[model samples]
Target: MKQEQFLSVVDRDEAERRFRAALEPLGPLGVEEVALAGALGRVLAEDIASPVDVPGFDRSNMDGFAVRAEDTYGASEQAPRRLRCLPEPVVMGVLPVGEVTEGTAMAIPTGGVVPRGADAVVMVEHTRLDGDHVLVEKPVTPGRAITWAGTDIAQGEVVLRAFDVLSSRETGVLAAMGVDRVGVVRRPRVAILSTGDEIIRPGTPPLPGRIYDSNQVILADAVREAGGEPVPCGITPDAPEAVRAALLDALAVADLVLLSGGTSKGPGDLNVQVLAEVLAPPGILAHGVALKPGKPLCLAASGRKGVVVLPGFPTSAIFTFHEFVAPVLRILAGRARPARLHGGEADGARTWARLPVSLGSDGGRTEYVLVRLTEDAEGAAIAYPIGKGSGSVTTWSHADGYFVIPREVERVEAGERVEILPVAGVRPRRVDLVIIGSHCVGLDVVLARLAQRGVSSKLIAVGSEGGLAAVRRGECDAAGVHLYDARTDSYNTPFLEGGLVLVPGYGRLQGVVFRAGDARFEGREAAEAVRAAAQTPGVVMINRNRGSGTRALVELLLEGTRPAGYAVEASSHHAIGAAVAQGRADFGVAIDIVARERGLGFLPVREERFDLVVAASRVERPGVRALIDELASEEVRAALRGRGLLA
Candidate 1:
């Protein structure tokens, strides 16, 4: 078969519009009766009204004597009133056998039925038992210590409404109403199919040029989480006949069909073709979507049933499934959409976060950038991009939430505000202290010490300049910086503004890092090796990100000459070491600690003072105070020195 081209490409919103339009007026598949014990997580099909009053009759709320108020009106400790004690006592779940008439009383326990002529119950402590009579010392009022019928729940009152998800609390209410079985909306059956010639089931011995089918496993659980019953359709090889058969079998037993792979414009892409032949009217409403990580997604409908073809990559498949298919499945299963997706700002489910780094986007497609959220010193959210591409399988697991970049916007600047859409119904957890700036192993030591004192902190590595900016904006309690000012020939202090206070951190030796045993850098003076590497032909050098202290040092060393890989920037010292050690680049500037950890050859250039720039207003805050105290502690200082930092 010839390679299939996309018939149409629409933006994400337009694609969703066409897909939902094809399957309009969606609702629950049907309702079914489920026992109360099995109703947890099921959506109620209709309102449940109480069949009878909670308390069938007037009952006693205390273990005391039941008597008319007038009979004990004048009874007191000084002068007591005597009454004949009835032989029969009221017991729980049993009807009272005798009546207390005129100057007579009967003992009744809690939840015991109240007898005729008894309007009140007195405490056993207040009454003294005699041979044939009881002495009442406290006055009694009519209807005291009594629980009237229907007091807890009235008859015919709606206790639970339609579409309410049954939890322990709701189930307890249903049990109290004597509802053993209840009607609930049926969970939609979702058919999951993973198609590819190179796909193999997990646990089947390894094979060359083949991968385990993880899409099915993830999609199945995702369907269940979205209130649908997953029906695994197994793997289908890249053949028209086999693909067609699998598609038919899936549709035969499912309300929705989800197939990953074979939707792109490759020669092996035949799932969309098979869907085109099998789907009824309004088939293949959208063949392509203008979205990053999910542009090849296809949405369709066969009469009332929904069909979706997700991208082949694991991250892409799951992302598109949640964005497009999960909402439809939730609607069909009688569950409401997540409040973060549709609710207003007042919902408390949404948060606005500032990006710590600028992001470049593909202007042709709307991109959703996954981020890890951390709170600032002022309790504001800071979003850090995961930066892993869509093909990666681990990005989704570590992401806290994601923010959207519109197709018209090509870049988002550092510290720009954006609304964060929470993932899996999880909101950003607030932390006690927020530390943003350059990263160092010594900072980790101090943070660990603070943790022992029950203090929590969040650290965002955005280079020295970026961190200082965050501190100036009042977004962070402290910033770690090692900036060297050429004018003053000093570090950190030269960059501090009036409102910022410099806290003594530690000193780290910054040096040129190269692969161990590289003759060009081994056993040479730091200045001589740097000069030799800069002038050497065909020598590639990894550069630090702009605004970092190391970047400034790099520029000074190069003397206005850009190397082969000068534009390729890494954000952290560890990344630089890794690049040099792995042969991605010949050399980069990083801390000596990273060189030692990654087993790279290091030529020390100079020791830079790494200090914390604290916001003066936040210096007295509890978390900040704890962080300062930890920094000054002997244990923390010893740990920092052990990590090759001069404390």
Candidate 2:
């Protein structure tokens, strides 16, 4: 079988233009009458006007006596004025029977209809009852303590406009207008299908060569989040007949069809082929896009109904769905588009942020880098790239937003400003503490403790040297460092300069890590194991990134011998342990905590001091003070000790 190639590869803007042109003049599907009880989260289909005036009639706002204003105009505590009191008392929800004439008053409850000839209401506390007459001690003005008819809501006034989303507040307004039902736009029905021979249901046991179908679950919820109803069509195999029947069924029952997988340029990729045969006029607007993580996307339409084929990769599928499909879904469901910040129209759904490190792009494709947002000491936003590729499933969940690199640009220099677009449904918030430095598992316990005390923190792992540089620039409140000084033979104190304070943190046992049963490293000393691994042929040893204290230690242990896989540098201790545990490398250096966590064998080298370096100007910050206080607490010390750190 021959692989089917893309009909055309176009830029993102051109692809979006072609797709929208194919499905022009999009609007809501239709309208339906829904009870007010079930109207939450629904968009109004038509303008709603009040049926009757709110409050319906003039009413008293407090429990008081209704009387003519002249009767109480000159009344005072020293010289009380007397008035004749009516026999009947006014009750709530009922109209008063008698009128209040000159020098006359009647008892009225709150919310009771005001009687004719009454111009004001006097509080019961200010008046005294004497037989059938009332003595007024306080002065009153006309229309005082009274709510006039139609004052809250006037009749024939539009209360809600079309396309307004109904919340609790909106529903309350409709209820006050005596409306039992409302006309709301119908939710668009979307059908989701997953295709692949390697796809299996989530609850089933894992097989040797199969993966669970996560795209279906992700797309189903995403459709609902975009205000569309999802109709799930179960997974289909690679067989042509099975996929064709599934596509036809989905098209017949859904207003839009989404098929993930089988859109790339592989012989087994046949969803696009099947879609081309079924779509009507103006079919297959664009087959491939010039964007990273979403280049294999295919867009098509059957008259007004849209059919999209998403890439099989989770990140690619989700990115394309939001960039292309979500906007159309919002229009069909009568939902408003998201608002962009002022002066950002050219960037389109993006805001400005500072990138801390340099990044390289593919040059041929527009790359979107997912980032986690944090703040500097001066409260400016910084975007740290996640660095995980498109195949990673956890990137979407962990990312705060993403920034794009254009196809023409190949590299973004450090400290360069870039425009970031927020992830759907994620609102970035300012954190209380910003810690930039090496990653540690024990730090998680400390941050968790801070969270219990209502402090939010953001940690960026950029190595010890980078963190020290950031501290000098006042880019962070504090930085965690574990730099070893060869001259002074100290861990962190020797590295501190003027205006920088050293906060004693904890010690971690750095060691050589390997698989538990690997005979080459299990029971040997740290230096001996490292030397043996470096000398042995085909014994791969993973190294840490430059500027890290662990990398310095690795260089010392290697003694100038570059072993296999020495160039493969990882960013964190966990990544080093993962490489050795997964057989990607024979040995690596990490902390004892990581080895214990990953169930790997450890040979201790030396205990390294991990301490905090604080900027002198930011030492008095509330978050920094709180962090210092927590570090001195016995609870934190105990927790750190439990996690294999010497606190």
TM-score for each predicted model, relative to the true structure: 0.51, 0.52
User: Highest lDDT: which candidate?
Assistant: 2
User: Tens-digit lDDT track for model 1 on 327-371?
Assistant: 889888877532211222223376799987799997989999988
The CA lDDT at 166 in model 2 is: 78
Q: Would you list the C-alpha lDDT of every candidate in the order shown?
A: 0.80, 0.81
How far off is residue 105 in model 1, in Å? 2.3
How many backbone clashes does every candidate have? 0, 0
lDDT for 611 (candidate 1)? 91
RMSD of each: 31.9, 32.4
How does candidate 2 fare on TM-score?
Answer: 0.52
Lowest summed lDDT over 10 consecutive residues: which window, candidate 2?
338-347
Write the residue-wise lDDT of candidate 2 on 459-523 in tens digits: 87778998898888778888999998878767988888999998889999999999998999878
Candidate 1: residue pairs that collide: none
TM-score of 1: 0.51
